[model samples]
Target: MHSVIETPMYLRAAKAAGMNDAEMKAVVDHLSMAPDDGALMEGTGGARKLRAAGRGKGKSGGYRIVTYYCGKDVPVFLLDIYSKGDKTNLTKAERSTLREILAEVANAWRESARRKAQELRRNDHD
Candidate 1:
């Protein structure tokens, strides 16, 4: 299973939307098991929109979660979230910001992997 990392923005949105620990856990567990569970959002540079069940509401009435998962080397990122009633789609600025964020995340993860591989090789030669 891939790791799920929740951003501060998502945490605050989840809290404001009345999502409790259990609900958040369920969302994370689902994403870890199936990181590609959602549909790819256009113009967000690989961001996805996942519809998760909230409290007593079903998926349709639940919450919308924005996430990014490049591959195994990178953890699934919970970028932002909101109740269905709060918003239906992200603004153009939000999409642009997400694209920039995704690029940075990918770059950082790649660097970390490179460093780890270097460490492993150094250890093997010891």
Candidate 2:
């Protein structure tokens, strides 16, 4: 299973959507096991829209989670979440912004991993 990273924006959105700990955990667990579970969203830099059932609500009236999973190496990113009643789809501007943000996130993760590997090698040589 891949690791899941919940961004502050996502956390805030989840809370705003009234998703409790158990609900949040269920989403994370599902994403970890199947990072590519959702439908691919176009123009959003590989973002996917996943339907999550809310407490006492079915998937139809639940929440929509926006996730980014670049590859198996990079951890799955929970970018945002919103109630279905609040918003059904992202605007064109929003999609463009998400694309840019995802590009930055992927680059940052690659750089961090590279630096960590270099540090480990240096420590081993010392």
lDDT of each: 0.91, 0.94
Residue 93 in candidate 2, Cα distance off native in Å: 0.9
lDDT tens readout by residue for model 1, 1-126: 889999898999889989999999999999999988799999989999999988788999999999998988788999889989889999999999888888789889889989999999999999
Error of 1 at 27 (Å): 0.7
Candidate 1 residue runs with Cα over 4 Å from true position: 117-126
**Candidate 1's TM-score:** 0.89
- Residue pairs that clash (backbone atoms under 3 angstroms), model 1: none
Model 2 residue pairs with clashes: none
